[model samples]
Target: MDTAKVVATFSVGIAATLTATALQVGKPSGWDELATGLLFAAFLAAIVVVVFDRLTDANHGNLIQLAFVHGWTQERLLKELQAATIAAVDANSWVLTAVRISTVAQVGISTLSGIVAVVSLLT
Candidate 1:
């Protein structure tokens, strides 16, 4: 689905970015800062993933997301989503806005973690 696309694209982009950075900066003389940055990035990613995974859950997540669907029938689910898709389309502005917001928030949190790791390494 679109969400997965966004996630994958962002991940690849970030990985590319980090690779370029590592090449330019080379490994630090000591593990102190690099370790710190890794820890920070991991922690931030973990927190964001937990939050979003909860949102993605079928039960006890967003009520509006559940209400928009007519049923879980294959035909209905397929109608909202193309084959091999994991997300449904919503015409509602609010639903779209929420998804976009969630995407940005997840990215922000993951970036924060990477930043922390870098700063720790630098120090």
Candidate 2:
């Protein structure tokens, strides 16, 4: 239900998937090693997100309580409470963005790696 929890959960899940894939995807050739490296990068980036989420959640408790007491109504408070502060929210947004970019990068790298492997085989 909480954003931080969601982020942590997803990050952990991604990390687990990446680690498993990397372990299972044995390198048949050099290009495959490169792809494995990209997967590892994704796993590391996801781990960074999980750490950031924990830090953000730890610091935002007071802000959330404040928003609860000061916000005008339940619905409005719920919306506002989504962000503890503009700066923190922005930082978290950046973290999420980084995670997504890392994920995309991993996929792109994997695709290219596959292409290289195919090309190598053909040659």
- Best model number under TM-score: 2
Task: Kindly report which residue stretches of model 2 are placed more than 4 angstroms away from their true locations once superposed.
Answer: 1-55, 58-88
Candidate topping lDDT: 2
What is the per-residue lDDT of model 2 for residues 48-119, given as tens digits with 9 covering 90 to 100? 544543224424566567766876576666556565465566766766766566555544444444444444
Q: By summed lDDT, which 10 consecutive residues of candidate 2 come out lowest?
A: 49-58
Clashing pairs in 2: none
TM-score of candidate 2 versus the correct structure, residues matched by position = 0.38
- Over the stretch 16-101, how does candidate 1's per-residue lDDT look in tens digits? 35533543565554433454454455445534444443233223233335535644665655444452233432233445565566
Query: What is model 1's C-alpha RMSD?
Result: 10.4
Error at 20, model 1, angstroms:
16
TM-score of each: 0.35, 0.38
Clashes of 1: 4
